[model samples]
Target chain A: MKKGKAHVLKIFDNVNTDYIISGRYKFKIANMKDLAKYIFEDIEPGFYKKISKGDYIVAGENFGCGSSREQAPWAIKEAGISAVIAKSFARIFFRNAFNIGLCVVSCDTSSIKNGDVIKLDLKDELVINISRGERIKTMPIPQLMRKFLDDGGVIGHFKKYGDFKI
Target chain B: MGKTIAEKILSSHAGTELKAGDIAICKVDFCFGQDGTSSLIIDSFKKSGRKKVFSPSKFCMVIDHSAPSPNVGVSEIHKKMRDFARSEKVGLYDIGEGVCHVVIPERGHVRPGSLILGADSHTCTYGALNALSTGVGSTDLAMTLISGKNWFRVPESVKITVNGILRKGVYSKDVALRIIGDLGANGCTYNSVEFYGPVIRRLSVEARLTISNMAVEMGAKFGVMEADAKVAAYLNENAKINKGIEGVTADKDAKYVKIKGYDISSLEPLVAKPHAVDNVAPAMDLSSIRIDEAFIGTCTNGRLEDLKIVSEILKNRKIHKRVRCIIAPASKRIFSEAVKRGYIKTFIDAGCVVVSPGCGPCVGTHEGILANGEVAISSANRNFKGRMGNPDSFIYLASPATVCASALEGKISDPRNHIRV
Candidate 1:
């Protein structure tokens, strides 16, 4: 069970990895913290300065839609984003997020406003709009994925289990 | 209910009978990481405190993405990959070896009925040989490396039935593009696509590879065709015979989530327009659009047959002076075969820069990058913004024949107009 409160950074649908962090920066930046400075570089200039630790992102459908580059999720995780709540996600991005211990939830983003203070409760599968006194239901994270997130990530999960044998 | 091809493979690997939506933990027969993502996987694996891989023999490190590094940064990446491979004592394919997908099969690593995974999305290309293969993130790959197993939710199969033989000037690339046009980019997301029909069965293994290779464009989990006589013949020709190479077939009463049919008897050459793979328009519709560059290689269509067709089209003519044409075979083996068959000489004589066999220009790491405001027609899969270097540049996807014809005219032109067949 986990809960976090943060302000929402609103973005639109089909936000690709190239838009998250362009390919040019991929080889240029070695450290994850350095890579965070370039997240959403093209889509929102000066994004790193505007976003603080524990901030959440609210996006529309198909977020993280291009390339299986793990750096997409790595940059977001390093940027101090608590979780990303979207209507849906590209499969690769969705998998990458869980692997990196970054939280992602699918829900109706229509009622969530930019700059609104939101509380995410992973165990309860709810996104609370504390600013507007609203509570939106989120798609329940799958059991296996819940285990993955609880253990911190795939690597953490592996460390706990030693082997993935059933 | 009888299992589909994807289900059968998963069930066998899981050591239990399974159905769609069932979770199964299975041993990985082959797992690889390309240059772009291997460093991350290595980082996560080390962070997890796992000092050694589960099985060094089952793992490979392929350095195809940015091989012969373009800059110091990429060169460091290659160095890191080499150090990791040496320390881990795994198979390593260095530069000039070939694209990972192309070389893996050429080396007989992609036997039928095996489960394969890679850190690159096109890893699903192995499904062309009746294998259950899919792409994973770097962390997921790290998990697989340590545990020798990965979890999978058996995907519902979408059966695609094709009818009639394709005419000349229209190849497997056209068939794949046509499907993407109809299905759009996300139509088959998370679903397995199984190709079945007379035309599919008759297609050579290399041609079938082209079809399954592009399944990622339509968001398919795996694109598979049954291993048949043609596949057996090709495997035999390549001398890759092994007991593990037996074909796995789905039952006649297998259930499918959705079934779609396409007829290719009169299918025209097709091209995916700028910015999106599913933004497909016919070659005839785009005849007036001129290209600054034309690329004829990738894991998608860099086989010997593709090179042979390009040679056939460019035998007596040269490319338009305005267009810079580049040709790359998919692998070193394919390049050697093309050289022996005089195809490489034909390309060189026809004014095309025949680069070494690797993933050249596909990811814009090296060779044939487009400048701002430039337009390129290529045989690669995706055409998203910044996919081939400059964000402002445009990329068009087409079959090798269409790319060849366009290179000659400096515009998107139908291969039929140039080739009498």
Candidate 2:
């Protein structure tokens, strides 16, 4: 996996899987590699070839909008991406990522830039600009939640927590 | 301290008695929209010139209806809606992320006890988690965007006591369709229906959702069952299922707005002929009209369990090659679950073409659009002509078993023939 300070290249507000992996590729998703080829096909058809694993995706407003299909996040997470930083998340995608243990953070990522070396601290709830020495006012994750994420999302968290206390 | 769930919820939130037909204003926990309606609703909100929305930013918008567009026009519409939502700083969900309801709950936005409102009629599905959620019209949606509150006619309660266990090859959809068939499309106009009985508790969340989501189809303001252990179990394992909003129940001696009972033990697969939800009858009685295509997905019945039931039935069988069977999940959660569980592989192996989630063939817009004179048996909510495309395509409504069996035989065969209770 490529490693570096997470530098976001773009922030698509409402990029959906139809754009990521269009229906045209439906018959072609025999594996992850094939699925990655079509991610954001509607937005910037060949953009995946330019993305790096350490690169961040800072989306505006409700970043991962649309159906509860895990394919959208599956394609995103499987594409070697480290994390998706968004302003907010749809109810389902947010939980799905948490459940699948995908690293997704919600913060004011609107101003974060392409190639900016940003450090996301899940514990302190900070997206620090290591290069610029700037700190973003990221929403703090509750201790219980931080613990949940640290354990690698809801499923793993559940595995650790065992039975849920409703 | 001595009240019911609905009353407790309304009192805690609205700080009032919350009687039937009385309107109350409370902060919304969640809101929903999609490509087709989101743009219009947002535009309407902008037109209202409202400064702040009534609810939190936890509102959602999904692009399910016109997803993977059948035409460039629909795509353009989705684009415009997305652009507007982005500009307004509202959530803009595009196609393939997941359907609104399924995605919302998965993401933790639809926690239990939270009140929800969606632009789509099936918004009532959120009630499955104990949220006092329901659907509203475009104008009302605009108002909610501005004020976060809508006037509601707290419907007089109607108790539908469903007794007797359903026979094998039958499901909650059949029970719901049976109720719809009995109550007609407009049977319980502006009333709340509470399902009660021994068998009602046995139904899964999917089944309950299947029942409550169709409340709109029958002109019900809302359909609920007493929040019980199953609900607690779901919330315990699933989303943040809280000691959710409680509500009023019919008095033991109090008169009901309406009361209906169904033995349902001997009910047959129903086919809502065409145009209207109440235009229904026994599926076996329906003419074995040759079908061009069949669909088994929609917000109404696109869940994994719905497909699982059908997959189990079709295990040793095959869909007639002459007829196409399209199955689309309602949300990505269900789709992915089906995949992880190998149900999708099972379905494909059985010759059924699985598609992405959303309102596909059920809306007649795209994905498995039927041609002229084609007949289809589906687990979807409606059977209006031109619904599955091709005005001449006759559509029959049935449970998954009926649809699967009919798909196997290339004729409308009752699911009962394949099993014994």
Candidate 3:
């Protein structure tokens, strides 16, 4: 069982890749750390400075809806976001997050408030909202994805198994 | 128990019987990346310590986004792609070749019933030819590059059937925007959307490409159409492969999670408002919103057919003096064709700046970045905030005809009032 507490940073629906990291910095800055500084610069200015290493980003439905730019998830992970809790996620963003070892929790984030401290219990598939004393159910992570997360993403899995191991 | 097109394609590629929700490791027919995502793909490939791509002939790269190197950093990234292409013996389309989505099909890399992948979201454009194509992130693409295979959770299917003919001035883009508006942005997430009905049969290949191109905007995994004689002719004429023309189709009793219908005979020209692709409304209704720039190009509406419509409208008239109209052909082949057909000259005479064939001003890298508080209209797929560079600026999405008409009026206007389409 894996458990951790993190403060929530609330956002809205359909937060696209451009909002997470603008296309202007896509080619100009190759370093993930440098790009992290500009995460959510367009939608939420100075977003990187507000979060600590284990903070959670809670968003509405269809988060990360535009573009297949891995940089979007990379920036979020590089900014030290522990997990992104949302009602839903775009297909590519969901796959990319798992590929990069970013924790993406799908649940009803409507009850979660900004700056709320929430505990994620991965083994129980529950989001314990310590601030409000509520325990919400999360979509169970698939066995393959759980394995990918254990190995720190597809690259780590590949390095260990020499194949996708699908 | 019949299989949908996606299930059939994935099952064949995986060499096993499969269904929706089943995870299968399938062989990839073709895979590619663009400049924006190719750098990360290369880095991931290098980090994996993979000495060679799974199949050089089956893979390629395009330098369409931020092409011609906007700055030193981009130039270095292009150099890396070139170097990697040289060493790996994979095909590389440098600056001016065209957008990856357009260039790949014109170069015969796309075919029916094939499973294609790319690092760019609009890669679904090839689904017009009946291929199971979708976009992926850099790491997944790199994994495919190394192993020539990727896993997929077969997506449930959605059947969208359209009846009746599209009215004059109402192009495929309008129909697509209408459907996207109805479905919302996340309506089709993780689903294979199959387009059917009589209306699809009459649309030209380019028009169908326009529709499939925006499927990603609705979050569809694959937006495919049934291949027919037109697709066969296209493959024969362009791809030069005539024998394998019998493309796959869904089973007669194929299951679909949802079915929606549309009749476009009375559908008016549509536009997606700023900051959201699904915020669609009739183009004429938004005439009060003035525009500073008018762009007519991208993977969605940058074909010769689109340019012909723009030329017809802009032939004898100059655009509004205040509006900066930019036109870009989707590929070099389309560029030469437009030049031969005199569309380029008509555009130049109409005071439009015709740039080289590539994804210009679409990705907000260069060519036509918007200023803060400015407004622009384009024929591109997405109208997300800051999509054209400045977050404060606004963007509206429409068809090329609408964009051209709006260019003439310096505001969002209807194409029907400008010309008889």
Q: Find the candidate with the highest lDDT and give its number.
A: 3
Task: Summarize candidate 1's per-residue lDDT along B206-283 as a digit string, tens digits.
Answer: 889999999988888899888877777666666566566677888998999899999999898999998888889889
DockQ for model 2 equals 0.01
For the predicted complex of model 3, DockQ is 0.87
TM-score of chain B of each: 0.98, 0.91, 0.99
- Give lDDT: candidate 2, residue B142: 58
Model 1: residues >4 Å from true position, as ranges?
A: A1-11, A42-46, A111-113, A130-133
TM-score of chain A of 2: 0.78
Candidate 1: clashing pairs of residues? none
Give the TM-score (vs. native) of candidate 1.
Answer: 0.95
> Would you give me the overall lDDT of model 3?
0.91
Best of the two (2, 3) by TM-score: 3
For residues B127-227, what per-residue lDDT tens digits would candidate 3 score against the true structure?
Answer: 99999999999999999999999989999999999998888898999999999999999889999999998889999998999999999999999999999
Give TM per candidate: 0.95, 0.68, 0.98
Candidate 1 chain A weakest lDDT stretch, 10 residues: A1-10
Q: Please, what is the whole-model Cα lDDT of each candidate in the order they appear?
A: 0.86, 0.65, 0.91
Order of models, best TM-score first: 3, 1, 2
